[model samples]
Target: MNRREWGLTTLAGLTGLALPRATSAQSAGTGRGYRYVHLDVFTDRRLAGNQLLVFVQPAGLDTDAMQALTRESNYSECTFVWPPEQPGTDHRVRIFGRTAEMPFAGHPTIGTAFALAHAGVLKPAMSKTVFGLGVGPTHIDLEWKGRQLAFAWMTQLKPTFGKTVDDAGGLAAAIGLEKDAVIRPAQEVHTGSTFLIVPLATRKAVDAAVLDRAKVDAVLTAAGVQRRGLYVFSTERGQDDATAYSRLLGSGGIEDPATGSAAGPAGSYAVKHGLVPSDRAASIIFLQGVLVRRPSRIHVNVASAGSEIASVKVGGTSVVVGEGSMSV
Candidate 1:
């Protein structure tokens, strides 16, 4: 569908979903209203992938206000876009979770780009848009299908591999899995963010695993690695389109539907450990959020120069599910 038609259809769908509408009285009392777009990232369909709320014009919202709005939205994360602070960037995006601000996050970056493009902030004919994130300038390559945004790819930072945890029993216990379920050693991997990449034996094992936060903290402490979320996956996909079935359980016991930041590190770890073929540039697709019923498809392309990873690109499609305004 064309962009206009697609937007109209999305609004119709949002009306059916019964999203809250701001009344005139509310707007008047608040003085100004911030327009925000709702999007589902890492999926083509609405209400399925990772949910991200992007405030297109957040001129008056401070950092605390952003965090409050993020918590109010009750999504995994939200983004506030501002005029470009860096010379070469198109915009500056601040990512906030329910409680704190994050330097970088995968779905928020991709979803914000799609939201801006859909709202006509970014030109439809432009092939790329850059956002100055907490981690620095992040380049997003855009692809268009007719008048619609087809997909967006973000170039993440270089992968950094850290200490490995060989205590299989402790790792399994930390995630409520059997020792045999862990097929390989768990290791710390970082791209934009740090995640402990755990290789499971089967998709069932990956799904069955649950995080015990106290135990997880203990395991990371003993391994001499900084505390981070766990990105567990299984490569034994029988007929799925994705290369790996994965899940992310954060240290706070909250699970992510889709994790773009972790996907880069996961792809890098897979290539380095021979979990997937590294003979050439490898495109690894991770199927996550299945257990939570918000299935997400995250694509990671890993290019290796001999034994070292040369580049990592995470890309996926997003749908504009809804739009609303918040009085601030």
Candidate 2:
């Protein structure tokens, strides 16, 4: 079948695999084989979260090969795990989206940790495991959720808050929404990577959002907000613990089921902007991808020192959907 028929037009020329499947080339004893696993992150239930593919012990693979594999997987993001180059770190992870590499992302971090534990590379205990990433060392605390499942809490970087868009009407139209759909000024926040956080008035407005890529690109370029994507959110909660509903539209037109990286800064934004009570620690749950049928629940914890934000943590569970070997 052609790339168009396979629903994989993003990397057809680069990867040469449209809706690629795993291909085994090296045997186990070759010492050059790679084991890849697919994971459903931010959800305990199977097949109901952001999909992540992790390539274990990606030895002998160069950047081009890694990017090819990621594009082939067709997941929102994929990771290559390696031994840490930095001292006192357990592992090193290189994150890649369908079209490019990412400094840091939420679900990939949580899912990668879960995959490591599942493969016996890292034991699932009460302690934390730190991975040296492109952004820096990221920490994850793990606990057993069931006989076959685990939950991971990942600590993200301290937010470097950025500018807030004053022209709400222009911002809304840029993303193909009505003027009044934008509830407030859109703010830029970067935990490790940057994203424009747009607040919509209602859940319907959020669900109705359609990105005109040209307009979005033009707006972002003019605003000097250099980042991968935009995160549109509403105060309307669809679940009990959910504080809001969110959707992330990034480069390559990838819509994330749940975005962990954005959640960290978003949680901090809630505290800083007083969207939620800023009196104490806050737990914010973001519901996403319901419109796409792959529902995800992301847990975000934000702590503050009075008016100042202290730290932000993003956590969730993941389930291994499939595992196989890949040939380099």
lDDT top scorer: 1
List, residue by residue over 1-328, the lDDT tens digit for candidate 1.
9999999999999888966788998656874778999999999998789999999989988888888889999998999999999999989999999889999999999999899989988766899989999999999999998878889999999899999999988899888988899888899998989989999999999989988888988988888978878899999976778899999975455678999999999999988998998753367899999988899999998987778888899999999998999875
Model 2 clashing-pair count: 0
lDDT tens digits by residue: candidate 2, 1-328: 8867676655555577465554564233344557888899999888899998898878889999899888777777899999998997889999998788888889999999888877878764446888998888988887775434467898888888898777788879987788988877778898887878888888888888888778876776777766446788887756456788888864454567888888877777777777767544456788988877889989888887766777888998898998987665
Which portions of model 2 show Cα errors greater than 4 Å?
A: 1-32, 146-149, 217-228, 250-253, 279-281
> Residue 247, candidate 1: how far off, in angstroms?
0.4
TM-score of each: 0.90, 0.84
Query: In model 1, what is the error at residue 140, expressed in angstroms?
Result: 0.5
Q: For this target, which candidate reaches the highest TM-score against the unseen true structure?
A: 1
